[model samples]
Each structure stands twice: as structure tokens, then as C-alpha cells.
Target: MNIIACIKQVPDTNEVRIDQKTGTLIREGVPSIINPDDKNALEEALRLKDKYEDAKVTVLTMGPPQAEVALKEALAMGADEAILLSDRAFAGADTWATSTTLAGAIKRLGNFDIIFCGRQAIDGDTAQVGPQIAERLDLPQITYVEDLEIDGNTAIAHRAVEDGHYIVKTEMPVVLTAIGELNEPRYPSIKGIYEAFREKEIKVWSLDDIIVDTSQIGLKGSPTQVKRSFTPATKSAGEMLEGSTQDKVRDLIVRLKERQII
Candidate 1:
């Protein structure tokens, strides 16, 4: 079984700060980590690999050269191979363009039995890339998968919905978007880390290497335009009533009456 796990390096939200003047993220000094949910996807792929003797897990990502760090981490977590898609032409790509590029890369890789991806990336939170990639590749997809079971060529997935989960069964060569509840991601071993840094080679591919429409890449292919981005105003302080409980209740009633809220 050939498993492909898609991941993205995102800024650690806890340390991220917003530029008030520009209404944008201040990424200059922010440290990046693998998207949390993508780690779950990778963990699931690794578990499947553990089950199948011939399973090969390939970690793939589309980002700047720095994203190679994320691939290295995946390698340390037991992925058989890593591939990085980095090119100036892929810069400023929205979900559609990103999915298009990934789908093209997957086609070039060929012979994948399963493709796993996170439910969404923290920075974007659009939750569109995985489904879009599935569409572009013309493959069956199950999103928001919390649990999965594989039997021969058939895959049984538990998908979370509004009220409950649905059990979906499908064949091989399917795409699955994993949520955090799926599994606990394992940490990289010391030996694996050393191998990742010294022995494993992360193959880098450019836009020229993958087959995709030139016009439908980067900022040009992105259709969603942000009109504005700003932090919400801080809430005003609440009023304090001084006196007995009865007095406080009376004052509160009067205040509510004055505001026509009573």
C-alpha cells in the first residue's frame, strides 16, 4: 500500500501576533509547526503502515523552501519518503490553486492507495483544499474522518457530522481528511531524527516539474480577495453596584429599564 500524507507548516498560533496597522499576521519572528490536524492524518497513515508489511508512507507538502523542515519531521515520524513542492510560481496560492498543484503532483507520483490530509489548516481555516484536491484528481473522498478501518481493498470510515457520525465504506485510492479526534500523533525518535537530518533526502519539485495549467497557479489563480481583516474591538468594562443585594438588584433593574432591556 502506498499512502500519501499531506501536511502544511503553519505559524504557532500561541506565539503569533497581529500587525494592528496592517491588519495582518506578523510572521517575521514567529516559529512554524506542522498543522495540528495534519499530524493526526500523518499518524493515521503511520498506523496503517504498521499494519501492512509493504506499506510505504510518503509525506507531501506545497510551500516555501522552509517547509522542508515539516517534511523532515514527518520523515522522523516513520514516513518512507518526503516530497516538497516549492516554486515562485506557487506563491500566494489560495485553496483552489494549491489543490490544483497538489493534485498534479499526486498524478506525477502515481500508484497511491490512499491520500490523507488534515481537515483544515490553522492559518487559513477554509477547509477547502482537501476536497478540492479530491475533485481535481477525480477520486472518492471522505472528510472529517474520526476513525477508519481497512479490509483488503475496502475502507470503512467514521465521518463526524452535526449530530452524529456516518459510517462510510469505499474502495481503495480514496482521499480522507482527518480530524484531531482520529488518533494521537507520535513523537519522532532520536534515531529517526538523526536519519532525517543526515540520511533521508527530501525531493524538491518546482512548478515546471508538475503538469498544471500555468495560468491557474499562484496569486493569479486565486479568486478569493480579502476585503478587510481586523481585530474585534475590546469589550467595555462592566458596571459595579455598591450597596446591599436589594439595592444592587434595584439599581440593575433601573439600568436595564433605562436601556429598554427590561
Candidate 2:
């Protein structure tokens, strides 16, 4: 069995900055790390690789050159191979454009038993890329997967829902968006880090290699456009009522009544 895991690098919350003019994130010179949810997905893929005798896990990521750091981290964790999709044309991509680019990269990878990705990217916060890739590839997709077992050509999985979880059965080559409930990610050991640092055969693909039309990629292909963004307004001054419990309760009730909340 062969498993493909999609990973992404996102801005560290503390260092995040939005471009005021574009309303998009400013990724340059910012602290970046792998998306937290994708770590769970990586753990799940590594577990499957361990269980299967001949299975191989491949980690792929789409972003600028900076994103190669995230793929290297995946390699240090235990992925058999790593692929980085980087190009100037891939900037400012929305979910749909991103899925298209990733699917194209997957096509280049050829055969695969299963595809795994995190539930969503923290930066975008829209859980659409996985399902969108499934649609583009005409493959089955299971989102919010908490657990999975591969049996021959079938995959038996547990998916999370609004109220509870549901067991699902799907064929091989299915795409799964893993939830954080899957498993905990492991830290890279000394030996693993050494191996990752020494490994010389990393696959890097550019837009030209993938034959992505210039017009159909990057900002041009993205349907969603951001107008502008600004810092939120500051809080206004407010009164603080501190007194006896009875007096405070009465005042609160009167305020609620005045606001027609009661």
C-alpha cells in the first residue's frame, strides 16, 4: 500500500500579519510551522506505514520555497519521500485554486492507495481543499476522519459528525481529511533528524514542470478576492458595578429590562 499525505506550513499565531491592501496574509519573514491538524494526519499515515509490511508514506506540500521547511519536518518524522510544489505562480491561491494545483501534483505522483490531509489549514480556516481535490480527481472523500483501517482494497473509517461519529467504508484511492482526534504526532528523534538533514533526494516541482497555465494559477485563478483588512476597533470605555450582591443584581435586572432582554 502507498499513502500520500498533504501538509501545509502556516504562520505562527503570534507572528501573523495581514496585508492591509490585499487582505491576505503576509508570509514573508514570519515564524512558520506545520499546520497543527496536519500533524495528526501525518501521525496517522506514519502509523499505517508501520502496520503495513511494504507500505510507503509520501508527504507533499504546496507553497513557496519557504514551505520546504514543513516537508523537511515531515521527512524527519518518518515519511519515506517528500515532494515540494513551489512557484511564484502559486501565490495568493484560494481553496479551489490550491486543490487544483495539488491535484495536478498528485497526478504526477501516479499510483496511490490512499491520500490523507488535515481537516483544514489554520491560516485559511476553510475545510474545502480536501473535498475539492476529491471532486477534481473524481475520487471518494472522507472528511473529519478520526480513525481508519485498510482491508485489501477497501478502507473502513470512522468520521466525525456534528453530534457523533459514523463508520464508513470506501474503496482504495480515497482522500481523507483527518481530525485532531486521530492521534498525537511524535517529535523527531536525533537519528531521524540526522537522516532528514542528510537525505539528498527531495522532489521539487515547479509550475512549468506541472504545466499549470499561468492564467489559471496564482491570484488569477482564485475566485475569491479580498478587498481590504484592518485592525479591529478598540474597546470603548464601560462602567463597572461593584457593590452588594442584592444591589448589583437589582441594577443588572434593571439594565436588562431597559434593553428588553428580559
Q: Which candidate is the best by lDDT?
A: 1
Count clashing residue pairs per candidate.
0, 0
After superposition, which runs of candidate 1 have C-alpha atoms over 4 Å from their true positions?
A: 20-22, 236-261
Candidate 1 lDDT, 1-262, residue by residue in tens: 9999999999998787788777678989899999999999999999999999999999999999999999999999999999999999999899989999999999999999999999999988999999999999999999999999999999899999999999999998999999999999999999999999999999999988999997888999988787667656879999899999999999999999999998
Over 1-262, each residue of candidate 2 has an lDDT whose tens digit, in order, gives: 8889999998986787778777766867889999988999899999998898899999998888777888888988999999998888898888878888998888888799889999998877899998998998899999999888888899999999999999999988899999898898999877778888896357889887775556656888999876676657769888677799999899999988998999
User: Residue 51's C-alpha lDDT in candidate 2?
Assistant: 92
**What TM-score, computed on C-alpha atoms, does each candidate reach?**
0.91, 0.88
lDDT of all predictions: 0.95, 0.87
Best by TM-score: 1
* lDDT at position 61, candidate 1: 99
